[model samples]
Target: MTYLNTRGSRVSIRMSKESDLTVLVIGSGGREHSLVKICLNSPIVSKVIAAPGNGGIATEAECHPVQVDDPADIVSLAQRVEASLVIVGPEVPLAAGAVDALEAVGILAYGPGKAAAQLEASKAFCKDFFARHGIPTAAYGTFSDVDSALAYLDTQSYPLVIKASGLAAGKGVIIAENREEAASTVQEMLSGAAFGDSGRQVVIEEFLEGEEASIHIMVSGEDYLMLPPSQDHKRIGEGDTGLNTGGMGAYAPASIITPELEQEIRDTVIRTTIDGLMKDKLDYRGTLYIGLMLTDAGPKVLEFNVRFGDPETQVILPLVADDLVDIFLKCARGDALPDKLNLHPAYSMVVVLVASGYPGSYPKGDPISLPDQLMRSATLVHAGTKINPEGELVTNGGRVLGVIGTGPTLKISAEKAYALVDQVIFSTKVFRKDIGWRQLERKPHKA
Candidate 1:
């Protein structure tokens, strides 16, 4: 197929036949597990491979070890496996120019190149982009030195948001409550005491107050397809009162995004973003993750991620009823995408199990136990686990596993998820009990 590149020049992409495609998914988390499963289910996919995959993924696909941040290593592996299509699951590889390397070697890859990946790799760049494009977001300032950051904080009100400009695995943001706290955070970030090089430059923005929602869009130039909206619980403690982690839990089709709100977001945020990318001449073709804050003013973008979210991906992918492989291929080839994706009339929820003291120091190598018979309604996606030398499943990372549940109703889905959560046993397991508390509370009680 032939399409117009970002430079307004004709470019051609060869589409592989369904029976001849081998997909290579890159990452080592529940999100990668979910992507591996989706690709395995596709009729066109003859085989699926993963790089440095976790224990659960090893059960489904061929797992190999590769440094995820090295573009040359990724390209070599794709060539070694003869991958028909490469699906990048994490932000690090995208920021490191893995897609650029693959495309240079004539390998089709589904992700934005390094230039376009700045939307997620650098908070300062993203905030500036929003300001330049008139996208609705909080007031912000960017600084590279401690004194300048502290001076910027003085101009803002209390309870501001301080973030490391570079990627820090979703743990680079902090909500500073007072002048002293904000100043200390700025010093720590600039001094490399907080997040290393990723924190040397910081972004200070006004705190946005509202319920948060996550929207995942598959973008093929001007055309796009949005999945069901989801909300992620970022805080470690219950009722969202504690330090932030990568994510604790998530639920899809968040009822908060009513038809009107979705329309407003489409018109005000998504459309504007696509126009901004075009204006900037970024040839983006991949998943566009919009982190939104639904405030009294309207739906405002909080941040952007170049790929699907973690626990959110666990829930959202199950609800998509279309052929995911085909959709990804079209995006990779810059072909026109369908206006809308077919979705199941169902709700999906995921409860993430973390190692003890996660979002901080935690134990590893602790043996894990699973149920004798896995329930059909639930899927156990591995996030941070490995097979120890003793040949046993053990904890290997902070967030260990994602227990996902699906049903016709949100309440039923939550029930099934928690039921399985009870059956899985690990020495240092930690998970949130209220995955869908807000939506469940809004439902009317049965008479």
Candidate 2:
């Protein structure tokens, strides 16, 4: 098949036969594990492989080691494995041009190229794009130096958001409540004292107030398939009171986004985003995660992520009723997407089990134990785990495991998830007890 590139060039895309499909997923987080699981669930999938897979993924797929951000290494690994379809799971590699490298070698890789990935890789670029396209977003200023950033902060009000322009594994955003804090944060970011090179250029934006929700869209040029809306808890502490981590937990479909609000978001945010990508001649073909703030003015985009979200993916993927292999291939091939996704009429929740003192320095190589049998509604997805030399499963990263629960109702899902959360044991296990507290509180009587 031939698809027209944004540069007015024609590119050939070969669709692999489902009967002989070999999928290669890239990443080492719970999001990648969910992608691997979905691919494996496809009856047409002949084989599945994961690079730098976690302990749970290793049991289901052939795992290999590769530098995720190195484009050449990824291309070589995909070639070695003869992957018919390559699913790039992490934003770092997508931002590093892994998709570009893979496509140069005639590999069907699912992700945006380096230029399009700038939407997620650089906050400055995204803010500029949003302004240029008139997309609804918080007012922001981008600066590359301490003096300039501090100067811009003076003109802003208190309690603003200061973020590292480059990727920081979802931990680069800081909410400054006072002028002193904002100024210090700007200095730290510009001086490389906070997030290294990722903080050299910073985006200081107005702090938005309201509920937040996540929308995951599978894009194929102007067309897209929208997944159920979700909400992620980023703060490490309960009631969202502490420093932000990658994500503590997430649940879907977020009850906050009503049917009416969903349509409003589609009209104002999603459509405008896709049109802007076209206007800029960016051939974006992958997941477009829109972090939204549901304020009095309506839904405003907080951020754009080029790949699936971590804990959100852990909860969302299990509710998808379609063949993920087909959807991924269609997006990779730039085919028009279906009007709507086939989603199960059920709720899903994920409770993340992190090592003690996560989003900070923590211990590794601590042994982990799992229940011999989980309830029918529960699934333990590995995020940071590995089998030590002694063949004992141990914590390998900050966020260790995501306990996913699916049921006909949101309350049941949360109960099931917490039940499994109790069964998982580790020396340094730390998880938020109230993953869906907000929604559950609203619907106190609903099952």
| Cα displacement (Å) at residue 180, model 1 | 2.1
Model 2 collision count: 0
Cα lDDT tens digits for candidate 2, 1-447: 556654444555544655678899999999999999999899878899999899989989999999998999999999898888899999999999999999888788899999999999999999999999889999999999788777787798979999999998777888999989999998999999999999999999999999999999999888999999999998999999888898999999998888999999999998889999999999999999999999999899999999999889998899989987788887887877788888899999999999998989999999999999888989999999999989999999999999999999988999999999989999899999888888888854343
**Candidate 2, position 419, lDDT:** 93
For residue 124, give model 2's deviation from the true position in Å. Answer: 0.6
TM-score of 2: 0.96
Q: Assess candidate 2 and give its lDDT.
A: 0.91
lDDT of 1 by residue, 374-443 (tens): 8888988999999988889999999999999999888999999999999999989999998888888875
C-alpha lDDT of residue 29 in model 1: 93
CA RMSD of each candidate after superposition: 2.2, 2.0
The true-structure Cα RMSD of candidate 2 reads 2.0
